[model samples]
Target: MGVLTGRTALVTGAGRGIGRGIAERLARDGARVAVHYGSREETAKETVAAIEEAGGSAFAIRARLGVPGDAETLWREFDRHADGLDILVNNAGIGTSRPFGEIDEEEYGRLFAVNVKAPHFITQLGAGRLRDGGRIVNISSGLARTAAMPQLMAYAMTKGALDVFTRDLAKVLGPRGITVNSVAPGIVDTDVNADWLRASEEAWQGAAAYSALGRVGTPADIGDVVAFLASPDGRWVTGHWLDATGGSLT
Candidate 1:
């Protein structure tokens, strides 16, 4: 049987890119997946259809995080489709490459609202519904540590906070047999980051060179690591910050 047979997983922001990749992987592993999308209904439905075509069970849900009561609404929608949840991947986030000085207050507020507050409350609600021995994988970024550029101050802060949440929540939920961890990916090539890379091939190559592995990371690279963490093989791992950076830290 698949490691996650009979399990249920909720993947937020799963309409595209890394989130889509992770959701697909979980479904392929025998889990009934709740594919959550913020505002991309078409992409969300497409994700669900793809899973069904692959002979996996999946359903689409819509809830924009960062709004009041959005978390509660999400769980309610999830309950309508599945009896319980075993995995929650907090993959929704928003930020920009503008320098710290250039980012206005409105932009900063929006970034924090989405990047930090959304995940915090989403996990809060998921905790109540997540079954014993559940797993949560928060998608963070390698920039949390390196601060590669001034434009990343706000984004890095949010991810740094998420890492702290991972450590603390692991302790809080440890007694309940739930595993909480963060996966920090480095410079993944996704639609979200495509424009920046396309600005210049040198920019993309520079990011690749930063990694000791000497290549840019794909969404699947991060997805594979997340799938492992959500599987039985990763049961012993919790309260850990996994570095999926292709040796970038080294």
Candidate 2:
């Protein structure tokens, strides 16, 4: 049996990219995963299928975040499949490639709405359903710590808020033996970054050079870090920001 044989995990935005990697990893570790998607139901189904094909358990749930009653809608669907929660991976998010000056009110509002508000309320409502000794892992980014790109200021701000949420939530849920932490990744090659990252050798090398490891990160790298935090091995580590950036900050 794997380390998380009896656990139940919910991974938001598991339809694609980093979230898909995390969902599959958790399932492989023996957790019954709930793959949450915003609009890509088909992609979420693909993630669930991949997990099952690998002898893991997973199901997909659809709920668009950043809207009215989004958290409520998500839990309502969650209740249909599972009775309790053991792990919650808040990995759903959006990035604004727009520069600071060009970001409109609607764009900024949507960023905070989906990245900040959705996760905040999702955790709040999920707290009651999460059993004692459970885990909460927030997928953050390196931009929150370093201003590497000025164009992603708003995106960075959202992650910064999430980091704060991780610290504060960890304390609040400590009594229940729940551990809350943030995992920040740097220059990961996900579908979202495929266009620019694969555009040219120069673009690829430039992104790779940002990390001390001299290579761009993969979704699995971030997934494994999250699996560690979700397992018993990470019991004593809570309320901290983990730099899974391949030494990018260094």
Candidate 3:
């Protein structure tokens, strides 16, 4: 039997890309997963279908983040499918649509609303349902620590806040045996990055060169790391910011 055979997991923004990857991994390890998506019902269904096809179980939930009552709405849907949560992966976030200087107030507010406020409130409201010994994995970005992409300052700012949330939350949730950690990824090959890499082969090569591994990271790479932390073996590690950047930060 899988280590998480009876555990339940919730992965936000799990419709596609890294979020979907994380959800699939948790399900593969035998956890019945809740795949949460903001607007893409099709993508969420695809994620659920993929998991079920692999002999795992999963359900889809929707909540338009950055709006009023997003967290509460998410948990409402989540509660309907599962009684309590054993793992919570806050992976939903919006990208920096343009350079920092060009972004206006509305865009900036939306970014923080979805990227920062949503997860914060989600954890706050959902923690009660998070059984003791649960795991909380926040999907952070390498940009939070490095100024590699100065143009993405606003987005980086949001992730930096998320890192802080991960650190402080671990302490708050520790007594219950819950582990909260940040997984910072660098340039995973996903749709969130398509605009940046689709420019040319030069762009793709440049992104890969940043990693000492000499290849672009994939969603599966990030998924495996999350699965490790969500499993029993990860019980002792908490409040740590894990570098899943494939040596890009080194």
TM-score of every candidate? 0.96, 0.99, 0.98
> Where is model 3 more than 4 Å wrong at Cα?
none
CA lDDT, candidate 1, residue 91: 93
lDDT of 2 by residue, 117-170 (tens): 999999999999999999999999999997568899889999999999999999
- C-alpha RMSD in Å of predicted model 2 compared with the true structure: 0.7
Candidate that scores best on lDDT: 2
List runs of model 1 lying over 4 Å from the truth: none
Pairs of residues at least 3 apart in sequence or in different chains that clash in candidate 2: none
Ranked by TM-score, top first: 2, 3, 1
**Clash pairs of candidate 1?**
none
Per-residue alpha-carbon lDDT of candidate 1 for residues 175-246, written as tens digits (9 for 90 to 100): 988899999998888888889876798998997998999998988898899999999889999999999999
The candidate that achieves the highest TM-score relative to the unseen native structure: 2
Please list the C-alpha lDDT of all candidates, in the order they appear: 0.89, 0.96, 0.94
lDDT per residue (tens digit) for residues 1-250 in model 3: 8989999999999999999999999999999999999999999999999999999999999999999999999999998999999999999999765686698999999999999999999999999999999999999998888756768888999999999999999999999999999999998999978987868999999999999999889999999999999999999889999999999988
* TM-score, predicted candidate 1 vs. hidden true structure: 0.96
Q: Comparing 1 and 3 by TM-score, which wins? A: 3
